[model samples]
Target chain A: MQESNARVGAPDWLEEIRWNADGLVPAIAQDAVTGDILMMAWMNAESLRLTAEEGQAVYWSRSRGKLWRKGETSGHQQVISEIRLDCDEDVILLKVEQKGGIACHTGRRSCFYRRLEGGQWASVDPVLRNPEAIYGKKQGGSNHE
Target chain B: MQESNARVGAPDWLEEIRWNADGLVPAIAQDAVTGDILMMAWMNAESLRLTAEEGQAVYWSRSRGKLWRKGETSGHQQVISEIRLDCDEDVILLKVEQKGGIACHTGRRSCFYRRLEGGQWASVDPVLRNPEAIYGKKQGGSNHE
Candidate 1:
């Protein structure tokens, strides 16, 4: 099936994205060359369209009720390498180029800021800076800490 | 801000995380040693519960309306070695041990499946296999392709 489909059209696996009851699918971003799982975001049709068309990783913000362009303010945008829909077409694989230091607004390279040590969740590193400082806005910066 | 709060009660950052609009925050996961991003997911109160207790990456599944263990079904569980909460305490960082060959369920090593070639979004590489083949039953496997 994959062989025949890979030849004529998009990969046969593109059909696997499972959109779920909602029109949204979970998208996982990773550093394409390094293979790091950077972050996850939601992608509806519109967000997906913008990401694919403009080659930017666009996401649907559940909190703000709109589309979000990664690094829009902080210059931490994710450059699109590819966008793969899962077998069910519900999830997406966003290969991105996150510029600057951290893709997360909170001043960390990534958003996860907890580590498990001796069975306890512990803070491993300090935040680099406030998102507002870099982004120059309150809500536009997603981090509150 | 960080010093005064550390002397007494909950750090100001921790307080900030508790009050997030959606009662949840973004968490980032990276390879502990290699620093490769494994994946990103959402964490609410309950999602945090499972992640801390289980020592792996857990996420809130909006579609399922429940908590999801990253690799319980797929054997790709992210074993966290360290965690950090940003100053706003809203974002989290996880240094984890990614189980299995790839962290992504879509058969890529990670979720960023597409790469930009020239100016078009392209499938960067062949999927390792149908997710069904590796994860086996229960995850809605799709090795059929």
Candidate 2:
């Protein structure tokens, strides 16, 4: 499939990416409308391909060493509007419509909630919802931490 | 310095980070005023500490195996306004004012100027300034490619 696509000079999409030595690239998810950055994750070729085909966020979980469909458990899937590659071709930008409004496993709008203030890290953004309510107590506690 | 700070229960800032196996973390630079993501890079503990101390972006270049002060050569320094950490404590975000209004080595405002269109990565953003003008002939051609 890749060979045929490359020959046609078509979207041999994955071929152009400058994957790291581990064959992975960092993917950042941004809100299409608000332009707020939601989260950052890693993706392998397979997951990237699947994301394009599926029109959603799919990442490779390094810890689990497996494919992770965002919001599969929590139902907070991201609907992709656009996929962008950086000038370096080493990173990916996913302009997505975050479904649940809450992108962080901590039930915050974004994962980046702690800001450095007065020589310490402080929670600048409030948690929109409780993790226990979103993922259930059994899984919520350890979901994204 | 680190020992004293830790003992005082003060900003033992770097200790809370979950650096990768290589003792590095992914850092994202975002435009403080416009909220645009300018670039992404890797940072070691020392670089992160220096960034906090200097109020500028300092990244650890994997290819060069050394520290990289943003704009040290190109004069496009990013003055950091805020430092944020993700909920997982893995990723770092810098809200910065990009000097000269250019962040990419390609002389664009952002490194992520390429957008995926019709199965191809297309340059969506124009070159705000010519690289040759910025870095000169010998250095410009190969600066960020």
Candidate 3:
């Protein structure tokens, strides 16, 4: 959508978003230093508010139906350096300082590790560390929702 | 979610994704050259498959409930150079060559032009072009769904 440089005068910034029927908006986490997109997840108003207040990444876990604080489980927390809202206001961008240098639960630098090559998805990035070491044995399964 | 370097052997690559209840997944578009995240949009299986086959971005508009071909209206089409799926098989990333050097309907180079500053969102980027000229006066409204 075409927009002028928006002057957001709303007292309640979270209310300005065009949230979906589920009261959620897509949030993308990008490395503040490298500009590498770490991951994408959903956030409700509560999670969005918490992220701003806490200066950390907090997302709504659709599957768990609760707030998913980044790095809470794996100790890989994302320290929020800046937050951005798209021109459309349906998407949020978190410029973060990824604490562990690993944003993917798969134990990689970023979640986007599989690139489509020759009509097939290939692992273009190596596993930086073992998943078992990151999530522990029982919770080692990757679930980035 | 922790995962191995996924070996996507499924005949139907689309089936591997964990689509939301609305059968939509979020797709991120990044500038292949600069790694600047241009925008984020939703895609159903149909749009995702079309993107792969057509080598361009085709998203599903939740507001309009139809397929949206990038640049169809604005001549700012995204020529995708690479597509990456997240480790959890939930999110899709498009590394693209953004046409006209503009990815935002706001006439900016990227949709993420607003930055959080002192609890307020401020427009930090300049509008590179005029939206009315890109989308015509009648279609000048920005809608990046």
Instruction: Evaluate every candidate with DockQ and list the scores.
Output: 0.22, 0.67, 0.59
Interface RMSD of each: 6.6, 1.7, 1.5
Q: Could you tell which candidate, 2 or 3, scores higher by lDDT? A: 3
Better of 1 and 3 by TM-score: 3
Q: Which candidate is the best by lDDT?
A: 3
Give the per-residue lDDT of model 2 (tens digit) for B30-144.
9999889888998888888889989999988777777889898899999999999988888999999999999998889988888877777889888999888888877732233
Pairwise DockQ winner, candidates 2 and 3: 2
lDDT of 1 by residue, A50-91 (tens): 686788888877667777888776778889866654333445
TM-score of model number 2, chain B: 0.88
TM-score, first chain, each model: 0.76, 0.89, 0.90
Off by over 4 Å in 2: A1-11, A140-145, B1-11, B140-145
lDDT (C-alpha) at residue A36 in model 2: 85
User: Model 3: per-residue lDDT, tens digit, A1-145?
Assistant: 1011121332468767888777788899999988898998888877887898899998888778778898998899999998999998889999999998999888899999999887688899888888889888887455556
The local distance difference test score of each candidate is 0.61, 0.83, 0.84
lDDT of 1 by residue, B35-142 (tens): 755455567765665576677888766456566778766777788776666444555667788887577777776554454444344666567767778776567533
Model 3 chain B scores worst on lDDT over the 10 consecutive residues at B1-10
Docking class of 3: medium
Query: Ranking by DockQ, best first?
Result: 2, 3, 1
